[model samples]
Target chain A: MSAEVFEPYQVFVRRDALDAMEHVGTVMAASPEMAVLVARQNFLRRDAAVGLWVVADADMHSANTDPQFFAEELDKSYRRVDGYSDNARRWKRFKQQALQLQDIVRDLESKEG
Target chain B: MAQDDKAARGPSVAEGAALVDLLLQMADDDLVLGHRHSEWLGVAPDIEEDVAFSSIAQDEVGHAALYYELASQLGAGDADRLAFDRPVGERRSAAFVELENGDWARTAMRHFLYDAFEEVRLDACTRSGWQPLQRAATKVRREEFYHRLHSRTQLHHLAKAGGEAFARLEHALADLWPYVASLFDLGPHAAELRATGVLPADAAALRSAWEAVVVPELSELGFGVPACGGTDATSAAHRGAHHPALAELLTTMRAVLDVDAAAASW
Candidate 1:
């Protein structure tokens, strides 16, 4: 008898409501329905997952693996939060000056009374 | 009055024995079927299915352990001894579970049939007045949900696949239907167990419920539902009678523990 061939399915899992689905593993199944079931058994046995997804491996497309795909030729710190550290420092100083002016006004009013 | 009120004082000798009988039937079915499923560990259709099947086998065996613990508390022997030491004639698992795993189609069909019955059975147990039985039933039913899902999905796929897949599944169902009927035989203690609130439904009621849920689904998938009949007493598994396959299964199941007289643990 000839053996039946099964296709590979990539599995994705979400741990909780706030979690994003992450690629966990792959399973072999005759159909997508069977793939979901098998994927649950393989991935959710130990950990509790809020959701699962199974897609045919062949259907998934990936970009070229060349380092240039994600490479940053120059420093990109200017686009990051840490790059705005000067603004945060200036804001803190402004808040302190505002508080000092309020104190000074209160002291002058007390002296006038 | 609530059934729990009737059983609040605990079971009498006969009632306790009846409970033990029911527990053994459940435990033995899970144990044997779990062992059979484990045989497909590395040889299933593929690696992922192998892992999935193995996980299911582990769940079944773990469930058997829980039932065995409950039985031990009810005055049956230790869980290990009761599971491995019993002779073939003393086991209460249905022939459907003890049958050799013939092929993926046969195995899938058997699982589909058995899981459907077990889901109904465990649902009934959840309503049981007995606290431990009810709790165990509730806990095990969660895991059983996945098992039912797995089997039902595969069964539907196979039945609808057409050509050879449909034929194989149809043949498997035909071969297993009669034996599956024997799973509902509650044996001599059925009336007592029902009366004592250990089981919310009698064997016949459970069988009818099973048929109601399963027959339409099978029909929808283009498979014929076998005609229903009363329990076959001659081949009843709960009565300690089993298929020929069970003997060999038990031998292999107990091999490790049986090899040494002094090995205290498994």
Candidate 2:
């Protein structure tokens, strides 16, 4: 069969249940069923995946086509994951305070006994 | 004797040889067909299919190695020697897997039929009286689950496409059916294997179980099931008598070893 009859699909794989489906690559297949089967070997040969999705290229839309779509109109740092980078330090401080409180409570209990 | 006691003690000397024979059959079929499937590596219909065939081929060889390891433990020989050094007459692979991969249609047809038969065979092995074979069968069956899925999906898509695809698959089924029955031939140890519960079913029972699965599905796909019988190449008596192609295939397989007899472990 000629390659023209096949359609392009964007392949995505989830390595585990908690993992997000990451786009691995594109594959050409005659149907969705074939696409999934093909995408499996193409993307998951070395790694066992818990999930896979193949979306038709025609069904996909992206803002990358227009460079202006990604141009920042204002600071949108809050919309990205890096905005919460200080959460690790904050959680560590909170945990230390909580542990101190627990020690004080234990001291009070021992004195009462 | 109870099945547990039998498994605990393992096979008698005769039964050990029979077990080795059975393992060789399974291993040789996988190794041979895996080589055939590997032939499509760069020449498959498309890049995706190339990847699929390559992965499936690797899985088949891996399964073959698993069986060979079991056979080696039973004192058949070194696993590598058992796989690569055996004489053609000693090989127990059926005519179905030994034949050439004529076309994509024939390859797909044989793959579908063979996987279906393998599933039934493995299902029986899962209950084997020999603990090692049972455990190995369980692991192999888990991998085969995806193989059946891939084969059935391909078969369904091609048959449903109708016209050229459907006709090609139909023709392939007709061409392969006579030899496909050879897959169920359990060789000379069928009676003892069954009696010992090493194999829970004999050839006829396994064949019926296999048909019970594939017949309805293939019929629904609009392909006619050809009459089942044995050809000279595919008789139960000639199960170990391999196709001539096997020697050619083995030559190619042994190319690396031929060059360096003491090649480092693969």
Candidate 3:
């Protein structure tokens, strides 16, 4: 898939799911200086991995594991647009809008049929 | 409801068996046809077309297997035997699925025709009251969306390119047309299945729906629509013989299955 030097990992990072902050994924490194080059030779032997994650999965903790943490499930909701009740009204409204859109599509299909 | 009829109600064990029986026919149609299509892997006229076609072939075969698994659950037969071991005539696939890939045009024509039928058929099936069949039909309908798009994409490009590609497609459609009609062939379940709501529409209605949707699209794209009128049914050259390519396809499809009939993992 990659014969022409297109920076395979950069291509990979775009196609793959990643976040600077979410769940930790595969992390690889040497020193800050040689890390990129070291990762390239080791992981890119075959065009396998596109990008590298520096953190380990175990190192990551969810609120449930954080023990006294999950103390504010309600608090995180504000951080998420979805978790906000005010947005819930919008979500419900949008959901109905999507259904109406779906019916319109079905109507078009029936006419086409 | 009568004694000695061996009939069924909704999705009970008996109904599941009956459902599976109907479903196997659908599944095998795609599976065997997909295997035949896959033979074209890497040999298509160009690389991009090859990737696109292979993706389609794989989807068809995979969907076929999914259908067989549903039948298997109803205790009809395992997917392997349902696919490979049956005698040819025992198969219920319409003649269209069995026809050769022909040239690219032929393949496109067959593809165009089959996708039209399948989309409508799946849509009707999704409306069925039986839950499992309904859910399965819904899934197949979603996959068919992509297949339909792929077929038309090639059809548009081939008709536009208009050279060897056009010729191959046209020839494929003409030779494939007669058997393609066999896709609407009605068998024993015409009344009972329709009565029980096993299928939302009969084969005849499906054929009409197909012609309406498909002919217009092809005509728009500059391909000829085979005559749908004026022929008496009995006189209609309805007999379908196995094209030579089909035999080769069966051999290849069963090659792995034939080794150690006891090997069940496939």
CA lDDT, every model vs. true structure: 0.86, 0.88, 0.65
Off by over 4 Å in 2: A1-4, A73-113, B1-8, B229-237
Model 3 Cα lDDT, one tens digit per residue, B1-266: 33333233336665565577678668867886787678788796544345556767787887888888777767776677887887665666665677666676777777877888888778778877565677788987887876787666657756776777777777776676666555665455556567777777887788888888988987887778677744423322232343445566677777777776677465
lDDT assessment of candidate 1? 0.86
Q: Cα lDDT for residue B60, model 3?
A: 87
CA lDDT for candidate 3? 0.65
Relative to the unseen true structure, what is the C-alpha lDDT of residue A81 in candidate 2, on a scale of 0 to 100? 96
The two-chain DockQ for each candidate, comma-separated, is 0.48, 0.63, 0.01
Residue B229 of model 1 has an lDDT of 70
Candidate 2 local Cα displacement, residue B235, angstroms: 5.3
Point out where model 3 deviates above 4 Å.
A1-113, B1-18, B229-245
Residue A80's lDDT within candidate 2 is 89
lDDT of 3 by residue, A31-113 (tens): 22222333333334334343553332234454566556546545565567664648878999999999999999999999999
Give the best candidate by DockQ: 2
For B1-266, candidate 2 gives per-residue lDDT tens digits of 35565656767999998899899889988999999999999999888899998999999999999999989988888999988888788888988898889999999999999999999999999999888899899999999988999999999988888999898888898878877766877888889989988988988888889989999999899877775544423343357667788889998988888888887367
Better of 2 and 3 by DockQ: 2
True contacts kept of 2: 0.92
Q: How well does candidate 1 score on lDDT at residue B79?
A: 94
Residues A6-113, model 1: lDDT tens digits: 888899999999999999988878888888988888888899889999999789998989989978899887788985769978999999999999999999999999
The candidate scoring highest on lDDT is: 2
